[model samples]
Each structure stands twice: as C-alpha cells, then as structure tokens.
Target: MTRQGQGFVRHIELDSRVGTDRYPFSLPVVTHLAGMGRLDLDPGVTFLVGDNGSGKSTLVEALATAAGFNAEGGSRSFRFASRSSESDLGDHLTLCWNRRPRTGFFLRAESFYNVATEIERLDEGSGELLRAYGGRSLHERSHGQSFLDLVYHRFGPNGLYMLDEPEAALSVQGCLAMMVRFRELLRQGCQFVVATHSPILLAMPGARILQIETGGTIEQVEYEQAEPVALTRAFVNHPERFLDRMFADDA
Candidate 1:
C-alpha cells in the first residue's frame, strides 16, 4: 500500500516538442515517458524495477539530473564529472515540486567510485571535511561499509535522495540495514527515488514499486507482483526447478 506522505518532487513530465529520433529519445523507456506525459512518484519511496536494459536506471538518472544533482552522483554541490554519457532526457523533463529541499543527494552505484574520489579530493586530507562522511574516506571502507556510512552520516532529515541500483554493493544484511535506515529517514521526513532489482530492498514497507515493463511501459505494481520479488521468490522456492528448465533442451 502506498501511503500519502510529504515529498519533494511529486511527478515528472516530458516536454512534447522534443525530437523523437535521437539516442535517448529512441530508448523505449524514454518513448513511454514521452507518450505517457507524466510519471508520479511516491511521496516516500518509489522503486523502479525491470530486467536489464529496460531503462529504469536511465529514468532515475534523468530525474536526478533534472532535480539539480550532479549527473555522475553526489549532492547538488558536487560538480565532478568522471565522464559525460548522460542522456538529454533530463533537459526536457519538467519536475513538479511540492517544495524545495534544503539538502539532497544523487547516489549512483555504477559511478560511486568517482564520487568517492571527488569526496577525497574535496576533503583534501582534512579530517574536518570528512566529518559529514562518517569521519573517514569512503575509499578506505569496504563498498558495503561506504554505502552504510552514506546513509547514516550524509543522509539526514527532510532530504531528497535518488539512488540507482544501490544494492550493487550491498549484501543481504546490508540491504536489511538500509531498509531500517530508510524507515528512520522516512520518520525524519525524507523522500527517496530508487532503481533496484533487489527484492529485499523492494520490501520496504509502504514503498511503491513502479515496474518498467516490456516496451517501456511503467506500471505501479503490488510488491508481490513486482518482477524482482516474484522471480526471486520462485527461484528461491525451487532453484533446481528453474535450473533444470535452463539446462533442458529447447523444444
């Protein structure tokens, strides 16, 4: 069930005038968003899930960019660019804001190494600058530890956060910890937009799972119906049943 709660940006709509025969514009997800005209976000957490190459991450990245975050990842203040491969979809997006947030961050799992490097550069070996990041270099910690510290330290009350595939660095235990932290942050009036395939992360209470279907249609699905949850449940319940089918000869 989706609970109506305080959120920052309420929804996103694509501009109608944008050209259709471009790189990102040609992506099915982009076409769907363009055709649909608008995508509503859950006031608390919105989970985008789909099979690989489905463009869930692309949409999340565009949302982050349109919301004033660095394309690579980090807080709005971060201006570092490891590379410039972002789609122009963000440029045409119109974000409907409930209110402006004092603080926010865009955390992209794929490029967090660059963000960490930037953090270290900004800190310049000063322990004072590292205080906001658990008082140590994110590079010094294990991948999972660094992510944990990000939530516990850098994230705070009334903040807006966009994360793409955060589960990339987490173990099952880490996912659970992040869920607990998410609850705490929600109580503190935070909002989250995340793209993930982790059924565990999708199980966070009251989160709205928006699954990007084939051909780029985005639909709001129940937790049980979410692709990750349904598939993972099936595989765990009977791994051999699935493996056998895979090994069996095609008809």
Candidate 2:
C-alpha cells in the first residue's frame, strides 16, 4: 500500500525579503507568491495552468530548483548547464516536505536536448546508465518518443516530478499516453507538479488545477474553467468565429 503521506513537497514558501524590483520579483507570479505567502500542493498531482507570459513556467522552474533538481532539467544528480536563463526565485524559496522523495526528475521540454547531451557524456563508452532511459541514446529517438521513454523507463515510485510544457514535444496521441503514465505514477506514490497548456493533461483524474491570472493571482479552478481547456474548447467548437474575432482588429 502507498504510505500515509506520499508526497515529497506539501507546499512552497517564498521569503518575504526576497521581493524586490528585480526581473523575477517584478514578475507577477513571484510577487503574487510573495504576497500570498505559500502555495499548497496536492499530494498526487498539481497542475499549473495559465496563458503565455503568465509566469507559470517560471514558478515550476523555481519549485524544481528549490527541490534540488537541475535548473535546465534532469534529475537532482545532474549538474550540466548549457546556459542560464532561470530566475533566482528558487534560491529564495523553501519547500515544505511531507516526505523526501527517493527519486525524482525535473523536465524542461525546451532544454531536454541539453539533458540528452549530458546523458551521452555521462555514458561515455559504457551504456549502463542509459538503461534507465530506455537503453539507448535519447538523441537517437524522436522528440516525442524520447519524452515518453524517459517517463516510462526512468520515472519510478516515491518520486517527485516537475515538468514544464511537456506537451511542446508531444502529439495528441502522445499526450493521451502521458496521461495514462501519470495516473500510474500517482498510484505508485509519486507526486507531480506540472506547468502545462494541454487541455488533455488537465483532464487527469483527481488533479488539482491552479490557474495563474493576470498580475499573478493564483486560483484553484475546475478543469473546465482552466484557460487552456475553455479556450481550446471554444476554438475547436467555433474555429471560424474565434478566428474572426482574433483577426477582428486587422479586419
């Protein structure tokens, strides 16, 4: 049976003194986090949903950093950095732990190529370590396949995972597969905090949806009300009308 308290992180606390007029602090999500004090997380799955530029990805990166994962992506043990584009919000934040995770990974879809390079470097001539990641070079696989392979072969029980825009590399079918994988992980005493725009991912059963409003106000909303779901539903249902309004200014 799963442990009574299965999650690694219970909530996140932002230091009050960390607030300033700096770039990240000036970001609405950071300011909102500072003002609100703490962001509570669900033990199973917590989804961060917002439109572009709403700072949801920034929050996920900070949370992953605070939890000791590499800023660019990968497990806690990875230390490779191609370049730095992350804010210092992680340095100023604290994670409240329900229980420490035995294993975990932070995945940034945009920088996963860097992670693949690092994996090859670590493997060198020996391919033993690659076994955990489907026993082959991630570079050899298609982008979506690599992502799925990482989840299926590398992810394990009692883990904490933070993902940023994983759908960026996935097809609709791939997203459906990922949802199934996520459910399995949840059952295995793993916890996930994902920042995503996929309405499909938001449909995970029992997932908590946290929507970041303009100016960084975070609210717990139902799946249907999530911006991605609502917007995608509207667009799919009435593409012509949506497109007409979207181009109304030009028209």
Candidate 3:
C-alpha cells in the first residue's frame, strides 16, 4: 500500500464495463517494459535511460502528458502547487488504475533557457527565482549552478518530478551536490523519473532504472548494472589506460 515515507501509488482495477478508450491509447496499454518489449517500474524513483534517439525522452514526455500535464510543462506543470487533483484532466496517455500524482514537475535540462524566461515572467510578481543568485538573471550563472538553484528552490515534497539529461552542464561535484539534495527530497516522499547519462546521478542507490535501447523497449535494472554506469566507471577508473589505447600510437 505504502512504502514508509513514500506515498502510495495505489493499484487500479479496471472494470470490464469501462471501455478501453477510457485509457489514453487504443493499442494495448504499454504498462510494463517487458510487455512493451523492456523494464517494469515501481512507484519510487524510475530512471529512464538510453543513448540519444533511444526514445527515452519521448517516453517520459508521454508519461507526463498522459497524466494531464502539458508536453513542455516545466517545474510547475499546470502552475506551481495550484491544484492537488489532476484526475479530471482525462487520459492523455494510458496509465494503470489509481494513477494520480499529488504534485508534478518536469525539468528539461536542455530547455532550461525556457525555464529562465518563464521565471523572468514571474519576476514581475515575485523575485524568488531571480534572487536565487543574488539578483543576477539565470543567464548570469553558469549552466550547472543555475540548474542546481532551480531544483533547490522549485522542488517540493510528495511530488513526481521528471528530469531530462540533467548532466548537460553539471560538473561531477555539482552532480554529487544535486544527489544530496535529491536524497533529502526523496526522504520527504518525492518521486523522481530522471533521464540522465551522468554516472554520478545514476548512482542514486535504490532508485529504479529503466533502460531503453535502440529498437528496444524500456527495461528495469539495478543502477550499478546500467550500461552507461558501467561504461563511465570503466572510463573514469582507468582514463589514461583507455585514452592511451583509444588514441594510442596512431602517430
């Protein structure tokens, strides 16, 4: 029913009387990665991973959209903490029964420029976002620092948050800092569905990982077992050796 500090993602029992169309799709529900042809996810932290063009972003967008969220909604999907119930929005994507997220945020790492603009619009009313960096616009801050500020100031507990390629600007140490913040939020029952390639971010223990390969469906695996994690570890653990071989004696 519930996972300690985590909220309950109750199971939905579809009634035979309810038409399939009540769901988001005509194609049978792609509820599980294995069913869709990869990984199943628990209600906790679900990481969707794959190479670029592997459809990872597409899947997260669909999930957010299906949950009555706009495709490009940022940290505040349908406004900041405006409404707690989104069930009335209807099916944009098929979901299991009892699917309702108390709060939701979508963080598109590359589209952070848009986030800054959106915040500027809000600055007319409240200067919270601008104040994040002592009155400097997010533009004034480096990419990674700005992202950290957003998560630090925008994120709340008991919410479902999605992140795409958050590693774009974060240095290794910054990523670790983000992880610390993430752990604090997770303890408060916040759930994360992140799409990232950074080995540091992927190392969040106990988070569920979904890997989507080329022509492959999403599948759940341990974080340590992820291809990106493995590859990054190998590279970092022995960079000189690997680099020497990679660019070796080509001279």
TM-score of 3: 0.74
lDDT top scorer: 2
Model 1 lDDT tens row, 17-125: 6757877888887888888888999889999999999987788889999999999999999998979898878999999999987798999999999998999999888
Worst 10-residue lDDT window for candidate 2 reads 1-10
List ranges where model 1 is wrong by over 4 Å. Answer: 1-5, 249-251
Candidate 2 lDDT over residue span 10-128, tens digit each: 89999977778878898888888898888899998899998799898789999999999999999999998888899888999999997899999999998999999999899885998
Clashing pairs in 2: none
Residue ranges of candidate 3 with Cα displaced over 4 Å = 1-39, 76-92, 97-99, 125-136, 240-249
**Preferred candidate (TM-score higher): 2 or 3:** 2
Quantify all predictions' global Cα lDDT against the true fold: 0.89, 0.91, 0.63
For candidate 3, the lDDT comes to: 0.63
Task: State the weakest 10-residue window (summed lDDT) of model 3.
Answer: 10-19
The number of clashing residue pairs in model 2 is 0
- Per-residue lDDT over 1-251 for candidate 3, one digit per residue giving the tens place of the 0 to 100 score: 22334433322122223234432222222233323322244556677778776656655666665555555557433354332332321232345523445676777676667667766777764766577534667777899888888677667677777778877889888898898888887877776778888777888877777787555555566877798988888888999889889888786
